[model samples]
Target: MPTLRRTHPADLPPVQRRELWAWAGYDFANSGYTTVVITAVFNAYFVRVVADGADWATFAWTLALSLSYLLVAVTAPALGAWADLRARKKFLLAITTAVCVAGTAALAACGPGSVALAIALVVVTNAAFGTGENVIAAFLPELASEDGMGRLSGYGWGFGYVGGLLILGVCLWWIMAGAAAFGVDASAVVPQTMLITAAAFLLAALPTLLVLRERARPQPARSGLWRTSFARLRQALLESEGLIDLRRFLLCIVCYQAGVMTVITIAAIFTEQALGFSTTESIVLIMVVNVTAAVGALVFGLVQDRLGHRPTLAITLVAWLAAIGLFWFAEDRRLVWVAANVAGLALGASQSAGRALVGYLCPARREAEVFGLWGLAVKLSSVIGPLAFGAVSWASGGDYRIAMLATSLFFVAGLAILATVDVPRGRAAARVADAAIG
Candidate 1:
């Protein structure tokens, strides 16, 4: 609902390159939680070991994961609103990072079938991760010049992918050795992984704190920031029709990203179930994908900058459709290997480009709030893909193929909506200020 004012790059307020990198730095740290703990190691542990003996236990854990994301989806927009009004982007990021770290560290205490503890820690950690990402997302425009936005975002994704891969590799080694040499319990492996992940988060966040500089502009000081944010959110919802570019973008994101989310959430499950890969094998496969995705992020980031965000996004959507089709038709072990490579290349590109596109459309003053709404789309999609997959799986007596096919529809639909979105006028924020004064 809010409109962005334009400015000139040369006249824009000063921001150092190190500061930009630092703003992007959190990705390096938080991604480990995503890669090593949540997606690769922890999720597998929960299904394979923690809930191994009980069907009901697995069901309950699944339900809890869904509910946790639902809570995040509900709260994220308002949190973003508060960030925008209060100008607490950095502070909010710190708080969310701490929450993620603390939650991850607590996983060290969880034993097999410690379902309640596992669920609680995961929920807190995931919510923190989601919220922190939104705060960091708002910092993008602050970090880079208008010309640099795409590249900087891409660099962040590339760095994040590398960071995640590094940690996943370390965890995988320990997991394999622990299981093989000592008859080690899965609980022991998980706790150590959690500690390492938590530590990485804290370490990764330091560069951002030390280097990223955000000169907060003045806003009318509101007595109730949260309440005001909620009111603004309501206004945004009501004015949705006028935000044609943003609205179209959101619709496309919902469809395309649902498929992307489905693939990300299910990659490990797919590899294990369909290809008969072991935990180590699956983790290795994911590591390969993520590491490659970092490279893809960097490449696409450059491409987006050169050609503009929308064209690059269309390229990614096409790649996604092809990837899904490839995955669907994959049969031989060799083909599965090829599919992993394809997924790795496009996964991070989609996210980096999507986030940059949002940055372009969002009003400067309301950047954080808009990013929060974006987060809601993403987290809600996380819930949808899993639930849809679960339902289809259940109906088909555990056949996952149909669910995957359904996911591809999202790509096609997303591509359609994305095609309709025209890029907003590219003008620096500082120029607008100078013009007003003149």
Candidate 2:
């Protein structure tokens, strides 16, 4: 059985190489859901076909996503606490994965004018996906030391994009190539698209379920789940008062991740509506972006470890601002392509850097609890960014360009907060917290 190296309290959890691969595999498994359902096919499909291009289509889509993120924000801390205290991260993760897979597959039953059905299913799938994202991430510290965290995160993210690209390729082939020959219209293949994502998610998730070990030792039950977890959360927050740098970092995450999440949720919608990209072209563009994002994840992961996490994240945020500027004024498809690739590069780097920074600052034996708070910050940003963008579009009669351009404010806000975070101090605080654990 795998065991932690306890020569020192500050030492990281011991992880087998294969187990690390299994851990990364969960990232791979879940990416297809995001790439297909949220980014490429389903969002646009819902906006255009399911809602019949109504003025509120965009708003409705965003609302579903916003509600899901809000649910995660509300529930993640409690879930994390429960999982950690019970050594049931795997069990909870499995439940979430099952919900996501089943919910995504159920989307196949949604068709034209099935807006309510589609929205409801999307909420279930996305909420499950978002919560599971945090649960899986709680294992990061067990797999790598501080120095290696960025690289490990980057590897997983890179592999995730590869999963996304693979699924997109399948989607493109089925929609543009195979379906036409089978006397099937593109719209008729929507069920096929949903099924593909669900199957892929189930298949890819198996490695993590089968091979990854649950390493946390169970603590005795303190009380009922809600009260106990909330009590733990309150205590963690009190202790975190001394870790001011970590507090600042969470604010940074909320601001920057807001912009990033906005782009992820709506880029395809923008291109299709503003740039007149057909579904095929949209898929192609996203596939290319996924490639660039993979490269950015790997390159920036290495750079952050050598150059310092704060600087790495700062560079990416600046790049995000620049990319958003280009996107704001992009009137031609070529220019949109340029803007998107730039955003893609920044997207991968910023996500990798931020996650690694959190892991670096997180206290030992409290991965689930602290990361739950991390999840709260991220999900709150998700709620704010997308809901704000959707509100703008809805208010302006679907003036999507104005809404798209407005996301830059989030990046600016994130940078302002990020500058205040002291990475070294946060790391030191975490170490002290770790050493104090008895």
Candidate 3:
């Protein structure tokens, strides 16, 4: 019988281990924003308070997310290509991180009925968050070998869930403890929580900037940024025969990610509105979900290396379909908790598997550019999913259950498309493309 050996920090050279921790630290840092601002806290606040229960709050909130993702969809590939050309992934990451932090902090000023200001800030912050996600993910190919990519990506995602858990825990405490802790009125809780989230992001993200070195060799100067970016984008889209499988995989990601993004963006809002959960209850529920998600990422990440990326992803999508079905019919709040945990498991598995597969399929020399395409797929899903949900919710007069049912179609379609991907063939293409570039 053959025994399997697990990789650990001690198994890596000191420098690579340090880089791994740093890379994971950024996940930890940015997850606070995703948890507190985008997924759990702010979305609920925006709908329930900022927009004051208007029928259009869901629409407006989803629309803001759509706009932000639209911006990322348009510019992520260009910016990623330019960053790769310049070997400036870290630089771009820093700039986007700053934008997110500043925008989140500025949300502190948005008092009651400040819907316009809140939306604008969310757009700016979310766009920066999406851009930064692409840049950081492009580093995965540089950091881990194909055999280790799933575990490494899972580690980062697991760490991210811990970050979300910690930050959400704090926010929950603050919200539950009430005005005495922060010396502010009850109404100020959301703004104060936003400030805490921003500070957490800034402080936790420092290790990445300080420790993760860019390893890519810069190519000689190309045509100007715009020309080169557009040319590269066109080539990646239309000219790279090796990327055909990768392109198909990305299309699969587009379909399922729409469902995933919709769930992430609106789960808290759904719990609040559909189940009559209070602010505190929603925060607590999300914190629990984060815990399960972290466990799922770590467990499935290890499983992915053995089972292969495609199988792992397919399994998760099936889980997603089931979870969404539960959400659609879950009249009792306890059932929502069950659905939340199911979603948590699927969320972690899908994210870790997808990123690892992309790392496996990306050519060595074009990590940023290829991952930019990955980002474009993700951002496009972000746009389409939220907009679809928002539109449905609006048309149905905020019938979130119907919106959730609609989301499951995306998962089913994605799973169907994903079945056709040839993982080994995709990997071979990536290697061939790398050799040609070399």
lDDT agreement with native, every candidate:
0.77, 0.86, 0.87
List the candidates' TM-scores in order.
0.91, 0.94, 0.94
- All-Cα superposition RMSD per candidate: 4.0, 2.9, 3.2
Q: TM-score of the candidate numbered 2? A: 0.94
Q: Best to worst by lDDT, what's the order?
A: 3, 2, 1
Worst 10 residues of 2 by lDDT: 1-10
Of 1 and 3, the candidate ranking higher by lDDT: 3
Pick by TM-score: 1 or 3, better one: 3
- Model 3 quality (TM-score): 0.94
Q: Which segments of model 2 are wrong by more than 4 Å? A: 1-13, 221-225, 238-240, 394-397
- lDDT at 35, model 2: 95
Scored by lDDT, the top model is 3
* lDDT of candidate 2 over 237-275, digit per residue (tens): 666565678778888899999999998998888787777
User: What residue pairs are clashing in model 1?
Assistant: 7-428, 7-429, 7-430, 7-431, 7-432, 8-430, 8-431
State the RMSD for candidate 1.
4.0
* Residue 306, candidate 1: C-alpha displacement in angstroms: 1.3
Which portions of model 1 miss their true places by more than 4 Å?
Answer: 1-13, 179-188, 221-224, 240-242, 425-438
